[model samples]
Target: MTGPRFTALAQSLPATVPFVGPEAQERAAHRPFAARLGANENGFGPSPKAIAAMAAAAGEAWKYGDPENHDLRAALAAEHGCRPENIIVGEGIDGLLGYLVRLTVEPGDRVVTSEGAYPTFNFHVAGYGGTLVKVPYRGDHEDPEALLAKAAEVAPKLLYIANPDNPMGSHHPGAAMAEMVARVPEGTLLILDEAYVELAPAGTAAPVDPDDPRVIRMRTFSKAHGLAGARVGYAIGAAPLIAAFDKVRNHFGMSRISQAGALAALGDKTWAAYMHRLVAASRDSLAEIARANGLTALPSATNFVAIDCGADGAFARRVLTELTAAGIFVRMPGVAPLDRCIRVSCGPEAELAAFAAALPGALARARQG
Candidate 1:
């Protein structure tokens, strides 16, 4: 053969990038975006302590991060009232999801997730040749009862649900989340993606015991901690399942500086609380901007707002195009119905001001088209 043959599954897959990031767009346009609000990145940035710690750790960059992530995992466990055995630190929730998928999913295995939930998670599912059964969102929220019903029927290996969900910014109260966790089908491990939980209102986290084997929770410093660039995340579950990550994860994937930064970020509790306030304030400002523009802003418990464009997906897309063209970067949902809204991430006032300035002209252009 002229070239080495790939696996049948790899050959069958499409060569597609699920997300075309803002940087790619900027490169095409030959200019930077006025407001980088598309990717749900925390514009507030990492805590001062984290930044300082990263700088301090830079001298030690020659050494690899701990394969075991010893001190960091221990701190996380203490924070969550769990033992160190229950946590596994990784590159990010995205990387951890890949490891989890590879560990549990074989060819032809089934997994369940909401239709338009986190695309990265879906990407991992597809990579492993797992059959994904998508449950539609009911009233802009992932339907717990429907997802559980399908899981019970199909008995899939894993089920995913994200609270304070991405793209839509809707959230279920802690009581509902607890109920969903309780209803997970027998033999199914629920993957609760709580990446944005820190920014959510009080009582958003479910009251599940840390040692619960039925569920594994993934969290990150990527959101309210403002450490998106650092790429640190962890999973909490029963000791046995947490231990299983060692079988597939890139043991030394985490950077030494990133580990130090994450540890410092955790130690700076006041910084986390301050970020919560800033994000909440930015959310309100975004909502106000939407309202002023004659759009409906959905309620949010996350660091972003999804503004309903008061029209169909076509109109919303036109508006998004105009916004992007006007030097403001924003993103909309990929699928229909949900695509009738555009998602805007929380940022400092200067960035939001740019967004606010561009929106009206963008709307005018969209209307003309």
Candidate 2:
């Protein structure tokens, strides 16, 4: 007898994933990494209050989380100066992106994104059989003008951009972003993934009208708030678009403990400054580490730096392999010329030191080969 038939979409899809977690690497290597710098996770970790809040919620996990995401959305609404109806919380931006693609994209629909932007967004678009039209990065940044031009021509179902973009850590100013918002083509929705915006400097987040239906901006507790494991992220958009997610989202998908943790983390305003300082210090630390090794680290507005290895993608690959062999888990870009650099995350002093020690050897070995 034949097994259950797979849908054509499922049958045609490849099995590869966007990211391989460090734990998977640890298992393959048979040893834990001396430093985990890949995946852009916050090595500094969650707020103390969030941890305590999660601990307190552990006993109540038998009950399901609030389906409406009431408390977390209220907190996020206040933080963004919008009403609760303006926000929708989900299991991080990744989950929200999936729901978004399902809500808007369909087979053969055009989706526009910058080449070498966040891969996961592309992954979601692909999963829905949407056609992706990628615009090349103008220099190292996502060129908003090029993206909007492409959108105007393609009139895509969605346009995806990550501020303080991943893999490169470059960001456009708020004014530039606002200008892009003003030019979105009719019937196109701009999905601004601000996963790292909280880690960016002042004026980084574009001040778009929350009631504007053409844009949907998302932020995650996963980054600066250090709640990646808690999987909390919220989107801000027009009320009608925000309500559209209700038809597609997993009503009880968010964990009860994660909700409590995220709410507590949101209330702890002091941690933002502390984490900001830690990230700034660590960025400098990575920069010095790169300079000492005779490399240059790109300017970054987020909690990571992309170090130019001063060679081709092959040389960068060797450097990454050597670093992993040395038990320092780091990642590089998947495509060039971005692949000519390896991305490093901001970590505490100890983890950063481990990377620093391992890097020179990795560089030397990469040079020899």
Candidate 3:
């Protein structure tokens, strides 16, 4: 039998996997991590209500989830004080990003983002053959002005910004974000990824008219909601832009059980509040741990912390490798300056204690090597 012919795009693209998960690392290490902190997942788990909802929905897995995500959109609309037409739910921010790129980017279309921002977003842009234009962070924070200038210069179709940014854990106020949005060129669409927004301090999220045509804000249930496995996320924008998602998105991509779980998670405000407190406490504990080792922890508004290793990227890389070998899975930034720090997720006492216990040995070994 003849093999199927590949599209030119598929044939031209390199075979690459974006992330090697902790389970893969464990397989290579021949042991499970004592503390899982690499991926910024909320170790606090989901609300009891959400778990119960999923359990109840499990029996109904034979049925398909609502293609339009009507009920979930309705609940979200009420919660956010926006009409349901302004929302488009997808598998997660990652999936939404792919759709957004597909909608806006033809091959060679320019997309602007910070040099070391979320790799998943970059991955999507690459998958669609979008040309990436990266601006460097201005002292640990994504430089809004620099991004805007680049957008103006390149006239890129999409501009990606993650407020309460990943890797560095720095953020800008909502007013600043609003100002940045106002300055975006008419044809350029701003993709404000707020995956960690719910975990940020007050005023960190910019306020924008839901009907604004220049921007689309994407959010997820993965971080503070502890529903990473649910693969539920939504994008908020003008009705027209939101409606455009239907043109190409997988109508029934969401699982029935995940939809039920996400709906429950949204309604459980108490659990969300509790998770916020736990995150704050964990941040403080992680800061203390870093100080004890003579490293400085960057201030974080998300469910993780990035600790400056008081050294270069090589030293940080050594520390990260040693940490993994010590059964503490953690990650680091991908580029220079920022790459001098390691990122660790916030978790419960047991997990934090394990990280703390293992740090000194890891550091010593890294130093000796």
Write model 3 residue lDDT over 165-250, tens digit each, in one string. 99899999989999999999879999998889999999987799989999999989999899999999999999999999999999
Tens-place lDDT per residue, model 2, 15-46, is 99988999999999999999988878899998
- lDDT per model vs. reference: 0.92, 0.92, 0.94
TM-score of 1: 0.98
Residue 177's lDDT within candidate 2 is 81
Candidate 1 ranges beyond 4 A from true positions: none
On a 0 to 100 scale, what is the lDDT of residue 244 in model 3? 95
Clashing pairs in 3: 174-206
Q: What does the lDDT come to for candidate 2?
A: 0.92
Ranking under TM-score, best-scoring first?
2, 3, 1
Please list the residue runs of candidate 3 whose C-alpha ends up more than 4 Å from where it truly belongs after superposition.
none
Model 2 TM-score, all chains together: 0.99
